[model samples]
Target: MQGIIHLWSLDATEPHELTTETLGQAQILGCGSVLHLLRTLSWVRTKQNRIAESSTKLWLVSRNAVGLERMQAQSPDSSRQDSSTRDSLAIAQAPLWGLGKVIALEHAELWGGMIDNPEVADVLVEIGAAIVSGEKEDQVAYRDGQRYVARLVKSDPLAFDGTSLSTENSYLITGGLGTLGLKVARWMIDQGVRYLVLTGRGVPSIEAQRRLDQLEEAGATIMVANADVSDGARMTRLFQEIEEKMPSLRGVIHAAGVLDKEILTKQDWGRFRRAIAAKVEGSWHLHTLTRAMPLDFFVCFSSTASLLGGLRLGSDAAAFMDTLAHLRHFMGLPGSSIDWTMWADDGMSLPSQEDGKFEDNDWGGSDKLAEYTMAPGIGLRILGTLMRKADTAADAVQVVVLPKDLSYLQGFYGDRIPPPLLSELYRSESVQPSGSSDFMEELEKIPVEKKRDHLATHIQSQLNRVLGFAPSQTMDLQKGFFDLGMDSLMAVEIKNRLQTSLGCKLPTTLAFKYSTPSLLIDYIATQILALESPEGIVTESKRAANEPEEILNKVKRLSEEDLEALIDEKVRF
Candidate 1:
C-alpha cells in the first residue's frame, strides 16, 4: 500500500507480465494521486535507463476537461460539489503534464508523452499503441472528443482593432520593475490604463525610478510594492490594501519569475523550487486571492520552455504556468497563458553595455539579437491581441511568436524539434534551395589538378547556404566546422547534401572526420579519381590516396635547403 507497491521494473531481463492485482489497482486509481504518479515516473525512468529497450514505453497522465456540459452529462450522478473538486484536481495535475514534456526530451527513445484528456480510456489505448509503435511526439491533448498533437507554426502579427483599457480599472503587474514588467507597465499606460499596481521584491533601480516618473507624467498613477508574491499571507494583505486604495483590480499579469543559469542536472531541489516559486506559487496565490473578484482578464506570462523543454532549468516555471492556465479554464475564469520567445527589446533582451555582466560575444549578447528575436513593439501588440481574444480562443494556452529561422535551436533539439515548428522551418526561403541537381556531370568536365579546387568551392558554397552566411562572407579553409558554429544537426545536413550532389554514399560522419573544407576536398577528389579508374574500385585507400600526412613527414625529414626548393616548386604550380 506504500513505497512503489505492485511496481515492475522496466529493466528486467525478461518482460514482466502485469498481474491481476496490478491491473485492478491501476483501474481503481485511474491516473492516481500526484504522489503515486511521481513514484510511477521514477520507476519507469530507472527501467528505461537500465534496459535501453527498443519496445515502446509510455507514461500517461490526464486532467483537463473537454467540455463542462459534456463532463457533467457523462457523470449524471455526480453533484456540483463533486464537479468543483474534480476541477481543482485537474488544475493541481496540470504541472505534471508539463513535467511530462521534460521527461520525453530526457528519454526520447521511450516514445513518452504527458497527455490532457477527458476520455481516460481513449488516452490509455492511444498511449499504449504509441509506446508499442515507437511514436515520436511527446505532448498530446484530448479535447472536444478529438485528439490533438502539439506542433509549432509561424505566428502572424495580431491585427489590432485599437482595443483600449478602461481608465477606472487598475491593473496589477507582478515583477513590474524588471525589464519585461516595466515594458508592460509602459504599454498599459499608453493603452489608457490610468491606474497601475507594479509589484516586485526590491526597490527600483535609478533607471527604473526615472521610467516610473515618466509614466506618471504621461497621466498614470503608479504604485510600487516591494513584496514577495510567494508569501500567501503577505500577498493577501497586499491585495486587500489594493482593493481599499485603488479602483477595482480589473486585470492581473503574473509575470514575476526567476531564471537561473544552472541546467537540470546541476539544479538541486532548493534551486529548482525557488526557480518555480514566483511563477508557480505566486500565480496560485494570486488566483486564489482573486478568484471571487469579477475581473476582465488574468494573463500568465509563460515561456516556450514548457513546449520545447530546452531552456535549462526553466522547465519548472513552464510547468506551473501550464497548470495555472488549466486551473483558470476549469474554473470558467477569463485567463490565458502566453508562451513567449526571446524578445529583442525589454524582456530577456541582451544585457546593455553599461551592465557589463556578459561579454559582447556571449550567447545572450547583442550578436544573437539580430537572429530570430522578436521586437518589443510587435510582441506587445501580439500580447494585447491574445489578451483580447483569450475568452474566444479555442484553447486557454497559446504560443505568441517563434523564431523565424530555427537553425540556432536545431543544434539543441535536432530531429526532436516539435512537429508544429518543422513546417515553418522548412518553409523558410533561406533553408530551401531554389533547385537541386546531381553535380557528377560538372565534376567530370573539370581537369584533375583543378578538380580539388572545384569541389572545395562547392563544399564552401553548401556550407554557407546551410549556415545562413551571406554570399560575400567567406570562411577560412583550415578552420574546424564546429569553430565555425556548425552543430551536429548542421553537420549531418551538409553531409547529406554532399552525398546527393556528388552521387556517392558518404558516411554520416563525413563533416566531422574531414573537419575542414580543404581536407574534405582532397578526400572527395581522391575517392572520385579512384572510382573512375580502369579497375572501377572505391575503398578507404582511394580516399587516402593524396597522403598529405606522408608529404608533411617527408618535408620534416628533408634538409632546410631541399625543403625550401620543394616549397618553391609547389608554390609555382
Candidate 2:
C-alpha cells in the first residue's frame, strides 16, 4: 500500500521500483486507451526485468463504467434523478468494461480487476478492502454501500405475451441489405409484418435482391431504400420518405453495423470512426428521429464481442456498448440491445475446415470460446419471443447469450476455475455432466463388426440434434455433410462431439473429411477398433451377444418412474 502507483501521476521518465499493486482510473477516451494503458504498463515492467515474475496487479476504478442491475432505480432519490442524462455520461465509459474483458484474457497476469461506482456514495474504503483481501471478482459495482457483481444466467424462453406485428403498420429495418438484416426481414414477415422499409447505404447484392423479391411475392410490401443511417440528413429524408409512401412506422430494427478487425496498436481513429458510425451514430439518429412515435419495439442487434471481449474487436466493442447505452438511457421507447453470439448455419462465410481448423487464427482472430453458436432459426425464435416482452426491455436492457460449455472456456482462461463472470456457467456445466466418457466405454464394448453400425447411429443422432430433426428422422447416409444442410459451425460442433466421446484428437475437418454418415462411421469405428488390435478384433469377454438385453435388464430393475427419467437423460435414441 505504501508504494501504490497511481496511473495518472506515474512519471514514466524516472522509473520507480515496481510495487505489488497499481491503481488506475478509467477515462472516457476511445477504447484504444485500454490497450495503450496495458501496453505501457507491460513495457515498464519489462524494462524493470519484472514483467514475467512480478506479482503486481493493476486495478481500474471508474464512475459508472458499466451498468449495474437496478442501480439507478434502487437509488434513494431515483424519482428526481435525470436518468437519461446520467446514462449518456455512463455510455462514454461503457467501452472500458468491454475492452477490459479482453485485457483480462490477453494479459491475465497483470490484470487485477475493474470496479464501477454507480452512485455518489463513497466506496473507496470498500474498494481498498476488496483489493487488499485478494477478491476474485474482476467485475464489480457499488451502489448505496451495497456491492454487486456481474453474472451470466441461463435464459429460459419467455412466452409470447405482447401483441403481434400489425400487418397494416410499417416496420423499418436499417442495414436491411446485409445477411442479418434480410434474415430479420423474413422473420418480421413471418410474424405478419406486411409493410417494411429496408434501408442500407449501398444497393442490394444479387442474393439480397433475390431474397427481397421472394419477400415481395409473399403478400408483403417491400421498399428497398439506399440510405446510410449514420448520415443525419439522409436518415431524416429517409424517414420522411417512409412516412410519405408507406404505412405508419410502428417498429424499428437497427441491425446496421461495420466490422473492422485490427489489434488496438494497429487501429487508427478513422477505422474506429467508420466502425462506430453505423451502430452508435446511426442508432442515435433513429432515436432522435422517432422518439415520439408509437413504436412497439426498437431492437439494436449487438454482438457478443461487446459483452465478452474479443481480440481485434475493440472498435466493435465500443460501438455496441455505446448503442446499448443509447437504447437503455436515451431512448424512452421499448428498446432492447441483444448481444448475440456468432450466428451460424445461415449463409455467413467462415474459415474453411479443410486445414488448420482448430488453430487460434482460424476463428477470424476472435477469442470467441463458444460451444454452440446461434443458428438463424433459433435466433429468430428468440427475437420473436423478445418482441412480446417489450416492457421488460428497460429493466433487462442488455441480453447476452453466453457460451454453453465451460471446457471450451477453459481453453481460453487456461484455468480450472473460471473468472467470476463465468462462475455460474461453470457451476452449471459441472453439475450436469455430459457423460461422454461413459458413452465411449459402452462403445468400446461393442463387437468390431457392429461398432460401425453403433457409431453410425450415434453420428446420426448428433446430426439430427444439430439440424433440429426429429429423433425418429433419418438422414441420407450417401449425402455430404454440407449437402445435408450442415454448415461450417455445425461441422465444428460435430467434430467436438466426436472428440469428446472418442477421447482422441480428431481433426477439425472430421466432418468434411468424412463427408457423409457412412464414411464418417467407417473412419471413427476403424480408429476405435484399431486401438484395440491391428486386426480390429475386440475381446470376447467385452463383446457379449446378450449385451443389449443386459443393458435392458439393468434398466428394467429401476422403477417405471425412474426408467422414464433415464430415457429423458440419454441423448441417443
lDDT of 2 by residue, 299-379 (tens): 777766664555333334443444454444444557777777666643231110111013232332221322445667777
lDDT (Cα, tens digit) per residue for candidate 1, span 1-573: 112211122111210232323322322233223324544544564455432332445555554522232122223333333354334444434445444454444444343455555365765565655546745544555554555555555545667776557899898998888777888899998888999998878888787888899999999988888888877888989998898899999888887776554333334455655665677667778877887887777888877666655324355456556556655666677677777776665325311111112222223234434564688888788778767766555453454456655666543343233433254344322322223445667867776555566677787887776565653357898976655655344555676667667765555345645678777776677654342322333444465786888788887899999989988999999
Candidate 2 segments whose C-alpha is farther than 4 A from its true place: 1-32, 42-58, 70-89, 118-131, 161-163, 311-332, 347-370, 392-396, 403-406, 427-573
Candidate 1: Cα lDDT at 496: 60
Best by TM-score: 2
List the pairs of residues colliding in candidate 1.
56-131, 151-420, 152-420, 152-421
CA error at residue 457 for candidate 1, angstroms? 22
lDDT of each prediction vs. the true structure? Answer: 0.58, 0.59
